[model samples]
Target: MATFFGEVVSVYSRAVEEDEEEEEEGEEDAEIRREVQKQREVHLNWRSEIAESIESSSDKTFQCSDLVIAVGQNASGFLSAFVLSTGNWDVVGTVTLWNERTKGPSQVTNTQLPEESRCVLYRQAACPSVVICQCTYYVAEDQLFQWTEKVLGSIQRRGLRVLVLSDCSVAEYKTSECITASPSPFLRTLKTSEYRDALRCPLMEQPNILTGLPAAVLSHCQVHRIPAVVYQCYSDVACPDSLTMEAYRPALSCLSSKLGKVDYNPSTEVLRKVVRVSEAQSNLYT
Candidate 1:
């Protein structure tokens, strides 16, 4: 009878121990769930803050007094410096355009920089150093000329001196096909005497001038008097307007002092005026 009692006590003790272990495990699971929930909340809050910041930034205004614009190609560093230099000053619509590669070579847009040769040539007109790599480019002559006119026109409109740097290899250019093609745009735009002068400028006389893409670009710039310089694979080429990081902060401070902030006024006011006039005419007819 005593042995039977001892066996019952042992079984009861084991049951109690198992129950406690289960309880401990349940608590640990609950703690783990809490941690996961906390992390999720933090992540969501961070995302919300980022979204709000973006929305606020879009409507932000800045002072536009005493604006100094700098234009260039492949000069992200310079552009950033310029921005930092003019802190609190309105820098809306700065940094005109850079050569952005489209999805594929075959995809041509109205403003797509034509052949790789023409692309570098365009940059050379604006920037001092241009690097050309050997690559196949497909663009029609007329489109290329038209795009060139637009780019040059932008420079004239902005009244900004631009320096560009292109970094590509000399071996990449395909020049023979481009050289023989008629530059009819030049013929149309240039006066007879000016066209004669441009033709005399090294490009026509030099054999395989198109093969040396930088030389061709400089020759063209020479004809137009656009103040261009070309350098091959070298950053040592001096740009007087190179903005240093140290000077950037001070420049911004100066700009802030000179130009107070102003709100961006859209041309929608003109449309509003037109609508009001139309409404008045309709009321008179009524």
Candidate 2:
């Protein structure tokens, strides 16, 4: 049986086909289009929150920030290093991903680490915080959602922002319009010729898969009323393209703008400058 995500792929494939049979089913086409429209409306409503945040932030500067939890994926080391280098912001380390190719579990580790690691560590910081998920579209949506619900939701104060960073090659590109409502917005299914161009091996050797993880995770944030941002960089990761960091501007600004709005919870005391050594050092504190 196809899962909900799987059904999405099937429907997308059918929707894109140019076959005569599809034209014969005008009523069906209209129905599918309506469903897609509904999804788009939901996404637009969700994105409006981000746009509003951006607008609301244009007039002020933030005063309350000390900690940042950065999670990296394939380029964990590069991304983590970049974040840590910019300042002393706490990099909590990578996310632990399970159920990949049914190979059990794998940690999103630094490039220096093994392909899979048994122990994944994260640090606890007490201060105004933001979570950055860098190129983490491969992560399971349900897991990401649950983590957001627990971590971001648990913050007694209001200023927890989730920033998603993605790098895309030409082949991986999808219109922002198409991805706003899907799970793996950063990835698209490979075409036969494109697969041949990238890998000399037979196309059959590759998996016929597309990912909507980014959109799924973002949608989850929207559902929970969490402030989130996404930005994409272009490079050779998927295709040979000129590199630039321009995509980061909007995300950074969004973070800055929303920081002032974060409320302080005296009881939780996450806003404190100093955390107890026991609380700060323990990964289990969350």
Candidate 3:
């Protein structure tokens, strides 16, 4: 009878131990669920905060002051130092560089940098900014000269201080902002459709000096008053103002030299128009 009693006691003990283990497991499961809930809340809050920031940023306005950009095929970007130098700008814009690979080549409307070359160019160039790409339609467009005129006319309407820089400035640039260290007088014209579009012009069967393509482009810039500056790739090569691959810079110094030093700041009110950012990109974590 005692042995039988001992067996019954052992069975009861085993049952109690099993029940304890199950309770412990249940508690562990509850703890895990709590942690998961906390993490989910955290992620949601983070997203909401980011969205709000982006939304509000669009309300910010550019107060078009002065702009300096490093124009290039691959490393095209606005220098941050230039931004700081020309702080409280009314507007800023950066072109999609030709050389860098686009990070998200699919999304088109949000950013305008090229698919093959995307270098956070606009991040530093934020403010009443628009992206232009030569690679996109330069090769496909017909009536290139006509199209270029339209684009430049549009840029002129914006009314901002525009300064273009070469791979390196060979001459000093004079502007409201700091002077360019190595100004390339050859690189003076704004990026326009005149030359690229003229290449497609049928007057010449091939691209050469004889086509009078250079004369046509020169006349276009002169009419538009867009200062054209060409760049030389290397020191060994002479900088040719006429070429397919080229750069552009400002000629404020030349203007001053011709007309004598005149501080345009007193008349700066002409470019003081302020424009707010679009509603969409304000809070984005650029």
Candidate 4:
């Protein structure tokens, strides 16, 4: 049978759906409500911690960050560049992304580098620090969660406000919502069914199929609760279960609360609100 995030996908998906259906079945079910309330408490509490840091920021500006615009190593880092731009909140940073198939797109640019060369990614300065990382779903699904967990964790500990937008995480998008029947083709003999059909699914034995990364990525950056949002563009049909625009707004509300009541949402007009999110983020540090 298929698995999800190291758990039995079929069973877990069905359970979640059933839980939702059961919720509709009896609106006044106190027990179910209590259980759900408890889960929400955990989720919201985590969000609260992130918001606290965002609210306490000293500056009053914001930044726009995008990562990994497309394939090819040269243009591959476009989204990363966007995510790293930290400037006036009123003018979010612009990130350009296009694929460089092979060699430098610019004649003056040298695609080859010395074998001994090495570079550092960050510097402590008045400007917002920039970090860029890229990976695909199939390439690094197993370590996806753990690696980002560390990166995000460190960024938060530094106290600088952060705006993180990963360019990829389609597998996560799929696994978070869909129910798979089997993880490995090796289990050909096993019966598979929709997640709605299964229960108490068995533990998965293979490495995570989807990078168990996005939720963890959100969790890490969100820990600081910096006034942040991600703009992800899907270049292919592989887009998974994207959170609805409606659902995303509420999360921003939760994040904005952390940014000291600034208008951190997209719909609000900053010109009238006069509360800048970028400057606000940087000053939160030091």
Candidate 5:
């Protein structure tokens, strides 16, 4: 090739041109991955009134004393059947997130009640400082740390106490005894050093560890020097059952005074309704 000034110029081979094109494509692929990660980021969406309140607050965060989180089917069902059934609580906010496992609405929808959403926040009218989060969504492993940070970051750390309720399979629990001899639907606790309160259940023994959102939350609290504890229920049932949900009753005994005196043991009708709803949702073969 020759320039307009008559100076000789060399033309690159097709191989070089193809290599340049490949480099450009790689850059484009990198940009796409970055955008996808941004989309998968965790987010907490508060109701209009709550948003305004937080904006008006001096700390720009929710003033919480006791933040109770119920994660998984049985744990959330326990809240639904016993505590939330009293109808003294109001939906204050929700968690909006997207990941590979999320199949429900990505954002809060007016058609569905807060309780029906994947992760919903509720506040007791009698005790505004006490908040309950019922999370039913599947939070992927990569997203757990982010989810914990976003959720706890929104609440004021001063005078904050966190309690996490979660359920797992009995098979996950480690014991030397026969599986049939071991108690099913039993509670085990894990707490941070900052947490000085007496636990209702026995501490989780060594050689056993926690994972998922509960572990993430506890780890965050431990590092931040926040008082937090998790009450994990190990159940044998593949589906949520009233017995499994009842296993968490003792865990909330300490919170009764703060949450107001409501019946911890809900009527059988309420239990049936809550269990039926969870069973319907989790029954893939039906």
Candidate 6:
């Protein structure tokens, strides 16, 4: 090809150039996705003794009879004040994972350090069959299924009964009546088909579905024929308060024997500390 001045000009195909750029970008995007997924993968870390027991066990799973899980601020606070304060429980394992909402280090170096951990497992010393999981971090939607599977899979399913306590905003509750007219902090129950025990509260109403980790655990239990129950507390408080924490008392009452001596009537001072800590955490702008 020659220009009007008899000088030849080399021509390049714009379409080919654009295609190469897109191909390179597509590969880069795929690599980014792979890295993100790897970071998001959930890992279950058990204590040395617990890991050894699991490995030596015939079933290769921890033998658990009662697994109680508290998911959210109010639920976890309730357990911290009433159940865990009993001083008969020991930290056994932890779940480590990273997500978009994760803050600070995701891997916990010391299981005893609760302040540094997001999800932790505690087992009763007197009754080893009973285990409690306190999860105070956000588990993204995509990670919920895997989180539930790994946590539940590690525990023996035979004769296992799971109890989950979770909290949601009162605004999320569906009702015809005014939400303020009804109780601000109340308990609604959901149970798997295999759970034949009497509920501590009314069943969750239709068209009002549950999401997040509690729902994920219940769904897994339902599918696996495991006896599981969830008590969801609807609270108006923006942060965890004593009232919201106390709303879960009835749910814990059903498992009183398994939980040992729980301080159902926690002292006012104890309650204040719980509420104060939550309020301090909530005070971001101040």
Query: Who wins the lDDT comparison?
Result: 5
Count clashing residue pairs per candidate.
Answer: 18, 5, 30, 34, 0, 0
Worst 10-residue lDDT window, candidate 3: 272-281
Kindly provide the TM-score of model 1 when superposed on the true structure, using C-alpha atoms.
Answer: 0.25
Off by over 4 Å in 5: 1-26, 108-115
- Would you give me the overall lDDT of model 6? 0.86
Write model 1 residue lDDT over 98-168, tens digit each, in one string: 12221233223333333322122211112212211111222233233433343333233222222222222
lDDT of 6 by residue, 1-286 (tens): 6788998755576568888999999999999999888778888888878888899999999998999999998998998888887767888888888887865355554333434466889987887888889998889998998899889998999999999999898889998777766677998989999999889898999778889999999999999999999999999887888888988888767668876678878889888988787677668896
How far residue 216's Cα lies from its native spot in candidate 4, in Å, is: 2.1
Cα deviation of 101, candidate 3, in Å? 13
Query: Candidate 5 on 131-208: residue-level lDDT in tens?
Result: 999998889887898898888988999999999999898889997778676579899999999999888989998778
Q: Give TM-scores for every candidate, taking all chains together and pairing residue i with residue i.
A: 0.25, 0.38, 0.27, 0.27, 0.87, 0.87
Cα shift from native, residue 86, model 5 (Å): 1.9
Checking candidate 2 for backbone clashes, the offending pairs are: 183-212, 183-213, 184-211, 184-212, 184-213
RMSD of each: 26.5, 19.4, 21.3, 23.3, 6.4, 4.7
204-248: candidate 3 lDDT, tens digit per residue? 112212112223334455566544322222111222122212222
- Model 2, 157-247: lDDT tens digits are 2443444444545345434454344333222212211111132112211332223444444565566555544344333343211112322
Model 2 spans > 4 angstroms off: 1-81, 89-94, 101-128, 133-137, 140-157, 174-211, 234-236, 239-250, 254-286
For model 4 the local lDDT of residue 231 reads: 32
Candidates' C-alpha lDDT: 0.30, 0.35, 0.30, 0.29, 0.86, 0.86
Q: Which candidate do you rate higher for lDDT, 3 or 5?
A: 5
Residue 284 CA displacement from its true place in model 6, Å = 1.5
